[model samples]
Target: MSNVVVQPTGITAADVLAVARGTAKVVLDPATVAAMATSRAIVDRIEAAGRPVYGVSTGFGALANTFVAPERRAELQHALIRSHAAGVGAPMPREVVRAMMLLRVRSLALGRSGVRPLLAEALVDLLNHDVTPWVPEHGSLGASGDLAPLAHCALVLLGEGWVLGPAGERVPAAEALRGAGLTPVALAAKEGLALINGTDGMLGMLLLAIHDAAHLFTMADVTAALAIEAMLGSERPFLPELHAIRPHPGQAVSAANIHRLLQHSAVMDSHRDDLAHAVQDAYSMRCAPQVAGAARDTLAFVEQVAARELVSVVDNPVVLPDGRVESTGNFHGAPLGFAADFLAIAAAEVGAIAERRVDRLLDVTRSRDLPAFLSPDAGVNSGLMIAQYTAAGIVAENRRLAAPASVDSLPTSGMQEDHVSMGWAATRKLRTVLDNLTSLLAVELLAAVRGLQLRAPLTPSPAGRAAVAALRDAAGEPGPDVFLAPVMEAAREVVRDPALRTAIEREVGTLG
Candidate 1:
């Protein structure tokens, strides 16, 4: 995976995603290895000189003032790993564990954490061989850098934890390492603290969430376009000139996307000259860009935070070039916590608005002349009536999950860590929000396409036609109500498919 020479500083979010989700390999720069050695030399010097460093010599957190004797130093590191590996919920997913491991390796590769190059290599080796450590879902206060979760990971490095087997079974870490032909690393001065002290877990989740949200947000725009045509709403509201006056970059991008999708629509043109239609549509259809655009802009902010975090060296008592090791509060997760919480709010609002559009598409009173709930026979079939309830239920859950986790902090580590960032919780709930949004958008896609299909002989635009046809190919043409769960799930799969985006782009050029 090395191109010419690999540098730790230029690693991308895509790189993180690759390592997290696929079989991508990591190649450390030789210079980075050399730099890590230099950093380790500083730690070695401090250990030899018998100086009382926070991580290298003295006890941790509330026990910071208690210094361990030389004989107990190694034991100090081991006990740290064992005691902190106290996470008690279900094990995290393999991908999340992989991402956390890769990110932790990236932090150490930066050479500021004073860990041996061998330790970083061991983590890389585990990643390349897929020896994912079993990390649990609970226990990170999001302070002191996702301590419990990282400790569970670090435990594998010491040959004392469990790893997920190839078939997703739990196996002993020692046995897994042996099967992979690797040895457990001995924790040295400052190494244990270095291993566990970073926001990699939460940061990894945030990065993955942002990646998914980008797709969902774009799909939201696509479904919104389909809904507008289905509702016989005017596309004039998405005019670039209208958005230019109140120029929000995300708004412009979303407006441009919807505008592109609505190009040459027979349904839109059918009503363009008709005096019988309402002058403007409801806010859900008219303000699609504003809501989704704000979410896009929020996602951009979260991306910025993730970008900065991807390269950050987040260990406390970090090594400096001039041979000074000083304690710093760099490990706090407040920034990521706030970013994740903000994104949750934005995602919830997007789902909320999309839910409204789905409801309008199903309501006889609101769907213009479309059949009630878009059923072929309104009274004989309940149609997508319950599907709207499903969307509404998800929206309600998202609203509750949207309550900011960052603002709900609690003290831990005996008040030594009095302030904490509930970042892990924020990122965890953000994942659920995105997942629910996917289903909500799927429901909208089903309703919108059904509405467009009923507009029948009138036909959707070229882009809208492509979206409708692509989904119909998967879920079948809408008609009398059949079992909708299977159809709804299929719609979600279509929404998730990259090919759906490709198909839409083939018809309407590239969307913003």
Candidate 2:
């Protein structure tokens, strides 16, 4: 966590995930109050000296050169929020909102956004108490720092918005603040612009994608192992010395992970001398590490970008060394915009391979000893046959969405805000890919576990049986063709349970 402090605002990736999942509290440092005071002081000095400052005296966006009268200063601040709360489409998930609020709070704590201590605290309170602003999901160029959605967030601070109470009632902002014993936050100096300008929303989404994809990465490795079990394919490819000669850290990690996954399986030992295993496995199964490892490397970089973003003040009019604020393009999200799309592609490929393995398991000829469609009574009970089809359909849809959103940009905001980073869409797409991939892997896990269970007397490798046991805890063995919805739900539940994941790790040891 301290590493996050020296690098960012001292908030780690683990912190955001905990907050996003509603399991932690948000507390800013006392020094953060001091930081806010300093930032606000710089703005006060500029105003007292009668020097023109951007966002303080000057207008915004197309109206930047126009000066605001002292009489309308408060009006201007409120107007900035009101005018920009034009977000459309679905409401953002509360977890994402909480993450955005915490992200913004940390950015302000860096002493750069010119917000006061209370205004920053209001954001922190929302995260802590779960009084999240009902920010709309759509309407962000991802350049100009996610204007519309963030404006809705700022509106809540100004005592104007729809807020969800802890009991799930939607209350008007004015009463909500009063009922919660919280005061309405007034934007002073650059606070209005700061509150509504930044990629916290996008950053929150990116952080979620990074975190969820990381868990899914481990899941994918396990899913591949299950596929190998079902296919009764070669395990020699995972030999440590083979990958040692030309080691990529990721390749070495994956080989070791898969090797341990199959370690004590009687099935693999049975195939030890088969020339067919040497002839090779399918590209999807054989090249699992190569394809999945690249995704892992991509994730390493994405994690750094997201962690840096927590402390980054991605808004206009940065406070410079001499207290002169020059409006820079820090708000433009090209860096993370491209990263979100790249991650989408990576996550999509994860689903792609997982679905193929699902296909391999379904094919009677390919899945030796396993009944076709994993059905004991094939024609009478449609056991898991359509489940593979569903997984395939979602995987194909993921491919279509994987087509980079960054590659297609449209001019907006009267051409002033042209070349939008559609980074919001990319972030959302990565989120979608994560959801699809998890559910797809769920199906593959179910089928593989079922296939391994069929060969009862012969125990699977130690790691394989442990992986199966983890599944058994969540879902008992399928006795016959039962309603698949429960099975799918159970599948998703296992993929999500942190305890089950730890159990698998303990049994299998270190994985890629």
Query: What is the TM-score of each predicted model, taking all chains together?
Result: 0.98, 0.94
- Number of the predicted model whose TM-score against the real structure is largest: 1
Instruction: Give the total clashing residue pairs for model 1.
Output: 0
RMSD of each: 1.4, 2.5
C-alpha lDDT of candidate 1 relative to the true structure: 0.89
Q: Which stretches in model 2 have alpha-carbon errors above 4 Å? A: 1-10, 166-169, 275-278, 473-479
**77-146, model 1: which lDDT tens digit per residue?**
9899999999988888888898888888888888888988998889888888888999989999898989
Q: Which segments of model 1 are wrong by more than 4 Å?
A: 1-6
lDDT of each prediction vs. the true structure?
A: 0.89, 0.78
Candidate 2 lDDT over 277-299, as tens digits, reads 54778878887877777788888
